[model samples]
Target: MASTSSFDIVSDFDRQEMVNTVDQALREIKSRYDLKDTKSTLELQENAILVNTDSEFALEAIHTILRTKAAKRNLSQKIFDYGKVESASGSRLRQEITLKQGISQDLAKKISKLVRDEFKKVQASIQGDVVRVSSKSKDDLQNVMQRLKQEDFPLALQFTNYR
Candidate 1:
């Protein structure tokens, strides 16, 4: 009898990388000519990033900076679920960007269904925020991973614990 090969699929990000990106963005905002004098603020919370600026253009600029910094750190842009910008007191605009760290139940189910439908030799089961996939043949597991890579999901997926 052969043991099964298994791996876990997770949607996660590096918190330290995110913090470093935010710090870089803040530095850039302070040094930039247009943003230097503005009362703009950028902060990273436990689960969200907060941005405060004076105008729509400034808000966009801040977002662009954050995205660029994140990309530089090899972080996926999909990890950020940006909220709608709202007007704050005194003509200020505020936006909250939530960091995605785990697979949602809906997405996990979708992934499991896709794996089951496409790869008959593999078994996929949702375990909380992760999806575990197992197969008798390692090649089948590799094939499943390849197929999943070809499909574009809303959030970024990472494969781990392959054994």
Candidate 2:
């Protein structure tokens, strides 16, 4: 009989990476020639980022910087939800970029399906937002993990609950 163990596959968003990327982007914006003299500001908050610029062109530049940073950090570009631009002091426009954490419901289902499809010999079940895989043999479980890494899911997935 094959011995069985269970593990959960979850994506733990890397908050530190996001913060680091934001810091780097801020530095670049500060030193950039055109933005150096503008009355622009970038601020990070718990739920979103606030970017204020003197003109639309500067706002576009800031958006580009943010997108680049998000990509560099392996974050999905889909997470950025642009809020309405509000008029700030001195005719400046302030834009808020909302950051979303946690895998979406659809993504969770997709991941669960992927795990099951890839490891045909193993059984996979979706528990809330995580995928739990069970196999009788340790080798089979290891093989599944290897295959998952090869597939390269968007989120940073982790495995747990091995029994």
Candidate 3:
């Protein structure tokens, strides 16, 4: 009998890094002459972020700052689902940015199917939001990881819990 090696594919981000990203962006907004005194604000929610500002230009600046900070922190740009700008009181504009957190069932199914079709030595199973891949050969597992990385997925993928 042979033992199998396995790993889990998950889509996640570091919450503390996100908090730091937002804090850094807020500091930049306060110091930047164009954004300063524009009353720009960034608020992080449980699963989203809220931005409020006086003008469209300021809003754009905030977005740039946010993106730059997030990138520097190694967060995927795809995580942000930007909402349309809405009117707020006293010539203010507001926008909501949603955070992408998990893999959908459809995507997990697609990944499992792909692995099953392409790799005879590998077995993939969908366990909740994660896809678990196992193989007797560690080389086969590495090949599976490489193949998955090549395919474009909407959310970021992190392989964990290797055993």
Candidate 4:
């Protein structure tokens, strides 16, 4: 029997890069004029980043800062894994942003479904928070990759584990 060539498709968001970007954004916030007074805050949990601000404007400014920093470092906005912004307290709002590397099980399932539906040639299965794609022919796998790239998925995708 011929061994099938297989690969895992996922978003390419380096966790370390994101951490570094967040650190730089924090530093910039402290130094920037408009942001300095707002006292915006950022915290990285296991799977997500928590942002807190005094007002909506401050929250947006912080978001912009994070986005710019990530973009400058070649990180995609799709990796942001954005969550809904909600009121935390009086004049305070909070946003929890998920990381592509630490994707939620629900999102992972969604991705796997998308890949299976979008790529008819390859077989895809959700393994924990990651999706595995396998195909007998490398050409089929390559075609799947190309199709994935053409579509706009909500989350950042990184391809890995090709064999």
Candidate 5:
């Protein structure tokens, strides 16, 4: 057996699932009486989802629907960063929700520090967008995973490449 075992900590979400969530929400918007015929539009752009609706009320409804759909699909709610609502042409309102993918430098450092402070036997190093954690004992790695899940971070975290 290898002397050391390791895993990578990442913060990411499924783009296809996000797209599906948006599509389902739009369909519900069309069927609902309050949102139907509002000429509202929801589009999943390259990095963000764009929501165009007639009023703030309608946009709020869309937000609820989108969040609900995402939850049903097992997508993390923390991935959405909602932008300010702005007025578009023809009195339409627009909102952009940016999708958070990787862990930021500040967050990465925080995670590394957390692991080091908690687990002396484990070693954590930040590698670009992901954090690599390794230790000789597999039990230490399992404890680290359990500890991380208890924390309420701003983003969703996933563990991968465990060996």
Candidate 6:
């Protein structure tokens, strides 16, 4: 019997990188001419980011800066699931941007189905927020990874624990 090869697919981001990006964004907000007097604020919570600004224009500027910083840190913008802007006290606007750290059950099922349908020799099983793909041939596993990369998914994925 041939030994099976497998890998796990996961969607996660580095917390330190996120912290660095937020710090950079804060610095830019303080230094930028247009933003210096706006008193805009950005706070990183356990699983979300709180952005508060006085106006819609400032909010947009903050978002642009945040995106730029995140990209510079090699972080995917897809992780940011922004909520609706709400009015706060003193006419301020607040927006909560949730961080996506895991794959949804629906997406995991879709991925499993795609793998089972496309590669007869490969088997994919959902394990919570991750999908484990196993096959007797390493080449088949590589092919599965390539196919998954080619397909556009709303969230960013990473492959790990290959054995």
Q: Candidate 2 — worst ten consecutive residues by lDDT sum?
A: 151-160
TM-score: which is higher, 2 or 3?
3
lDDT of 1 by residue, 9-103 (tens): 99999889998999999999999999987789998999999999999988889989999999999999999999999999998999999998899
Off by over 4 Å in 5: none
lDDT of 3 by residue, 1-163 (tens): 8899999999998999999999999999999998889989999999899999999999888999999999999999988989999999998999999998878999999999999999998999998988999999999999999988898888889999988
Query: Where does the lowest 10-residue lDDT sum fall in candidate 5?
Result: 13-22
For candidate 4, what is the lDDT?
0.81
Worst 10 residues of 6 by lDDT: 32-41
Clashes of each: 0, 1, 0, 5, 0, 0
Sequence-dependent TM-score of model 3 = 0.96
lDDT of each: 0.94, 0.80, 0.94, 0.81, 0.94, 0.96
Per-residue alpha-carbon lDDT of model 6 for 6-116, expressed as tens digits? 999999999999999999999999999999988999999999999999999999999999999999999999999999999999999999999999999999999999999
Clashing pairs in 4: 10-157, 10-158, 11-156, 11-157, 11-158
lDDT, ranked from best to worst: 6, 5, 1, 3, 4, 2
Q: How does model 1 score by TM-score?
A: 0.97
Per-model TM-score, in order, reads 0.97, 0.68, 0.96, 0.77, 0.97, 0.97
Say which prediction, candidate 1 or candidate 3, comes out ahead on TM-score.
1
Q: Stretches of candidate 6 above 4 Å error?
A: none
lDDT of the structure predicted as candidate 2: 0.80
Residue pairs that clash (backbone atoms under 3 angstroms), model 3: none
Cα RMSD (angstroms) for every candidate in the order listed = 0.8, 3.7, 1.0, 3.2, 1.0, 0.8
lDDT of 4 by residue, 60-156 (tens): 8888999999999889887676799988876788899887664567777766687678767678887766678897889988888787778676777
Tally clashes: model 4. 5
Q: Could you tell me which 10 consecutive residues in candidate 4 have the lowest summed lDDT?
A: 99-108
Per-residue error (Å), model 2, residue 71:
4.2
